[model samples]
Target chain A: MLKVSVISPERTLFDGDATQVVAPAYDGEVGILTGHAPMMALLGRGTLRVTEAGGERRFTVEGGFLQVVDDHVRVVTEKAATS
Target chain B: MAKGRELKGRIKSVEGTRKITRTMEMVATSKLKRAQDRVVAARPYATSLAQVIADLYTPELAERFPLLRQPAATGPSGGRAAVLLLTSNRGLAGAFNSNLIREARSLIERLERSGAAVDVHVVGRKGIGYFRYTGRPLATQRTDIGDRPTAEHASELVQDVMRDFIARRLDAVYVVYAKFNSAISTPPVSEMVLPVTPPERKGPARDYILLPSAEAILSELLPLYVRNAVYRALVETVAGEQGARRTAMKNATDNAGDMLNILRRTYNRARQAQITQEIAEIVGGAEALKG
Candidate 1:
């Protein structure tokens, strides 16, 4: 499982354990799984889906970045709302 | 009788004032709590942005991005600066707006003394009114940002300044606002926001795969950093405004309570004196009639 955190300037939208995550990068969409190589990408405006144990959570995010390191994923966006 | 009545009226008025002040104090307290929470909520995004910048920043990258580089020369007549002053919309907050305006004035003066041409951009109604009253030229006057400042508001506030800085029309950008240290201590401070100061790197550089390119990422991050800085200042100013208003209202309420006590005591004393005078007059008339 990957520890995922979705943060916006207003609040933290989501933070928990996730099995898979997909984000809309500036150039394209990027997917992350556990033990993925460390990476950083600028986020575009689109939906970000995180698959947790209970269910799948989704957030509409815009204009920020995503970082992954040691199975820890951080999504910081300028604007984000749970959708 | 008239004196007693007058005192009673004064006491009633003070009591009403006390009630209003008390209500305002309570409102300010709740608003302050929410503002403080917003400040806390914004931290995660700020920290992550700083971390990403720290990881990606290099001396070589600074050379390519004008935002990361200091102005080459700031000699007299060579430097251009902009000061963004953040104040509150209303006037009830005691010394909150004044403190920010004072700090901004001094910062502008310092910049002028250094021979930098300073452009003033003001936010909030109080600051705009102050600049207009002083006949100081303002490049922009924005009054729309209220108690709640979002990232969009922040971007709007700083976009022009950032653009000018990049175009080499401005050498530096400073933001003057109240820094919320605690409930009791929120001091006005002036902070330089640009040209962007790269955060100190935290650890050995990791070879993370950079998507798109490092230059492209840095370019995007620089503006985000400025917007975040402005956003933080906006929230802190709001929190400080609420704190200041709460303290001011609390003091006003306490003063009104004291005044009410004094007025009540005076009214009672005057009433007793009037009763004593009326009895003396009646007894004197009865004694004269018996004689």
Candidate 2:
């Protein structure tokens, strides 16, 4: 499993080992998993879905950035909304 | 006796007001400290990015980028101009919202008079409210930017404004915000952003090298710069509001205290007079009884 993290300015929204992660990127949604190529992407306003070790956590984020490297997916968003 | 009663009422009202203002004063002070500290901490990261951009500058890369192009003053262009107007999310911070609104109105008027169309990018709720109410056109709005801000925050705003600039959706971009000087003073300032010109500085040159190309580094760093600048302004604005609120609350509390002091004196005088009159009445009654 890859390590997936979604962080907001005020607090860390989600941090766990994930099988796959999908986020709203600059243009559209991007999916990342273990052994994915390194990429830097811009994020937009939308939901972030992470399939974790045992459960999946979903977050709605508006604005910010995403960095995917070496089985580590990190998301930094301006604000996060959870349903 | 009547005077004492009136003074007592006045004192009680003043005391109540004092309590309220005192609480406000304390709240503002704590917020101000937090804002000031946050701004101070974010400086290194902002300035460091700036320094990197400065280092990235080269005579070769300077020639290629349209963003590096400079516009001469005193000319009206049919091209687009984007304005980044920063206002507070909430009010009660003395003239913070109005000052920016006034300036924005005047600029829009000037742009219209010059036959230039403008696109405004708003940063806070106040600006949003004003522009929406005034029926002005806004390119975008980033609302609810509160006490703490980060580079990530700046990046998003930068993306829109920068894209517009690059796409020629905007010919120029201007940032209007309060330049915080100290706890007591802050002034609204407008700066031209976009076209990534050589920063106007009266300092000595330093040695540096370009990481990729000057253009590449600049393009990469420019957004960060824009973001940091916005974040800085936001933090400063928050801090300034806190300072102003603190001052306003403190003044209110002090005035209430003064009023209470005056009322207390009057109340004491009235009570003493009433006591004296009662004593006289008792003595007169005793004399009559003796006689």
Q: What stretches of model 1 exceed 4 Å from their correct place?
A: none
Task: Give per-residue lDDT, candidate 2, residue B129.
Answer: 90
Alpha carbon deviation, residue B289, candidate 1 (Å): 3.7
Which residue pairs in model 2 clash with each other?
B67-B195, B80-B171, B154-B227
Clashes of 1: 0
Looking at candidate 1, what is the lDDT of residue B7?
86
lDDT (Cα atoms) of all candidates against the true structure? 0.90, 0.72
Ten contiguous residues minimizing lDDT sum, candidate 1 chain B: B69-78
B1-291 per-residue lDDT for model 1 (tens digits): 788878888888888888999999999999999999999999998999998999999888788997876865554455889999999999888888998999999998888987888999998999999999999989998888898999999998888888888888899999999999997799999998998888888878889998878888889888999999999999999999999999999999999988888888888889889889999999999999999
True contacts kept of 2: 0.00
Instruction: For candidate 1, write residues A1-83 as lDDT tens digits.
Output: 89999998888988899999999999889999998999999999999999998889999999889999999999999889999
lDDT (C-alpha) at residue B231 in model 2: 72
TM-score values for chain B across all models: 0.95, 0.83
lDDT of 1: 0.90
> What TM-score does candidate 1 reach?
0.96
